[model samples]
Target: MAVPAGVAAVVREMQDRLDAMPGDSPLRDFLSTYQRTTTAVGQAITDGVFADGEWVEEWDVVFAQLYVRAYDAHIDGGHVPRPWRIAFDAPADLPSLRKVLLGINAHVNYDLPQALLGVISDADFADPVLLGKRKRDHEAIDGVLASRVAAEDDELTATGGKSLVDRVLQPLNRVSSKRFLREARQKVWHNTHELQVARLAGPAPYDVRLGELELLSAAKVADLLAPGQVLLRLAVAGFGVVLPPAA
Candidate 1:
């Protein structure tokens, strides 16, 4: 609905900072993609897209150490029988070793909270910023149903007690599309990546896995990091992944 602007991912604010910087500034190398990410993330949030709290932040953290692994893989994977020239590309400047080390402090300052501020529902008891999403979604869908703008599309349209039209009006069920969810998930992972990788180098001495980071299998890490990706999973889990207490 009519949210009083600035209530979400502050894309303009972020881009303005990037625009004010010099083109050759080392930050420029990462700024375009970084700013684009916030715009994408802001739109996703405004449209009711959402994901686990840590996902977008994680995406940023994942980026921090990914290239290092990719480069190593480019070298080692070539020592194989076929010797496929699996080239790995990266931004020339890449996030500064310092920026990556710090997890691009700005992303941690904004993205995760913005996602929550936009998509959180009343039932998301842990978050208060989005309590209004329930009301807004209700008014939006009520207006749609009242105006008869969005009709059933037949493909996978619900066929029982409540049709697509009925469900669209549910206050607690904010509408979401695969595309939106994908965007939301990306934002979360990006931010989480930043957070996790930063923590990997933080002075904390140790981390709580499953709490701070998720453990990944070696093969999965390879696919995710795309090459040499060091044992970020192992690094984060200086301890290890812990199962929750039985209910």
Candidate 2:
């Protein structure tokens, strides 16, 4: 699905916060990495949302689909999705766009494989170490998602229905998350693991995975840049289209 506009605002807000951090901020590098990620994803969205002189409303959807298909299907033995969450009626300046991008990226990585089960092969699905990571990540991520769902539910209960999370974190919310996790385990992780067992598991598919990693890393660096010139550079490099350069 296409990312929500709320996500764009979320990233912009986080971009400002990251800017306020001191040069000496201990987590500056980590933040910078994410910043680049935000920028790239934002740019990708921009490309999709405003592509070829028209508003292609479902750009994020196409992009995410392509990404999942491209996934190596060999990460720690399974795919892990990273989905985004946005708060509504957020403070104007803090749009929280960055986090949303991260979330979608997460969801794609974690949740989007079985949907393309035909494209990937069974011989590629079996690896023990990798399979283990898939399980652990699911176990851990399940908690995070449950927390959000529960928190949203609790919010409504406490507010007598005043909370967005509470209202929206309904049955559909939990079902999708569980469904994605189950599919990834059965189709990508377990299948890959089985492949590992049937034949000799080879060295890691580092090159392909690294390329995908770099795409995300570049996005992180691009997101934290100042408004004028840097933003233009990012746009041109990422989208192949130009806007007025920073004044």
Candidate 3:
């Protein structure tokens, strides 16, 4: 299916704004990566990469709407999704990459599963063949993610000069980034299934499960920004100090 018009407009607006920002700005870097991923997903939908390309396009729009809400909230000093609250609340001095990762964590871990259900019907879950096809398509985005991240690495390194810590993380990131995406995507599937099960049980159970997912994401973000991790975050911030600003 073609990319939804609404999704296209949202992405275009984001890309335009990101284009207008200073290249070295943390928000610009975050939105640059986000825009590239959205563009890839849009192309994938147009190319019929998913068996249910229409559903995939709808899911992309639903997922992006949540980000738009969070971003607007951040700008207007209004409420945001709890996980995104952490990202917006992060210290201004935090490393640019970490800022981007916080947004990724909130969006993927917190918002993706909820968005998944919005795209597929409860009946769609019953067809094993169809389910498998949708899942395969969902999982295939890992390639898109890997490519986008690899291409963005130079910009990240330029923004924050690599440190010993970054070097140590390099081999691990190369090995584990796709693995991480796969695991995260799998968890989203599982969460969607669990919510479906809970819905059959009762509203109370469904609500509780949803709350648990939100709490889990909040705790994960807390760990990411926890005091124990401060030194590493600060180190990355310091890495950029000696480097000249982006042109």
Please list the Cα RMSD from the true structure of every candidate, rounded to 1 decimal place. 16.3, 18.8, 9.0
The per-model lDDT (C-alpha) reads: 0.32, 0.35, 0.70
Instruction: Compose the digit string of candidate 3's lDDT tens values, residues 69-120.
Output: 7877877889877888887678767666667667777888888877877776
Worst 10 residues of 1 by lDDT: 80-89
lDDT of 1: 0.32
* Best-fitting candidate, scored by TM-score: 3
Kindly indicate the candidate among 1 and 2 with the higher TM-score. Answer: 1
* TM-score, structure 2 vs. true: 0.27
Off by over 4 Å in 2: 1-104, 107-148, 152-169, 184-205, 209-247
Candidate 1 residues lying further than 4 Å off, grouped into runs, are: 1-4, 7-9, 40-211, 214-247
Better of 1 and 3 by TM-score: 3
Give the winner by lDDT.
3
Tell me the deviation in Å of residue 108 in model 2: 6.9
lDDT of 1 by residue, 1-247 (tens): 4222432324454456556766655444334444444444434444554442233333323332233233234446633111111112223333232222122222222233223333432244334444344324322322322222122212113323233443453332223222222333344434334344334555352234222322221222223223321223222322111222212
Model 2 CA lDDT for position 228:
34
Clashes of 1: 27
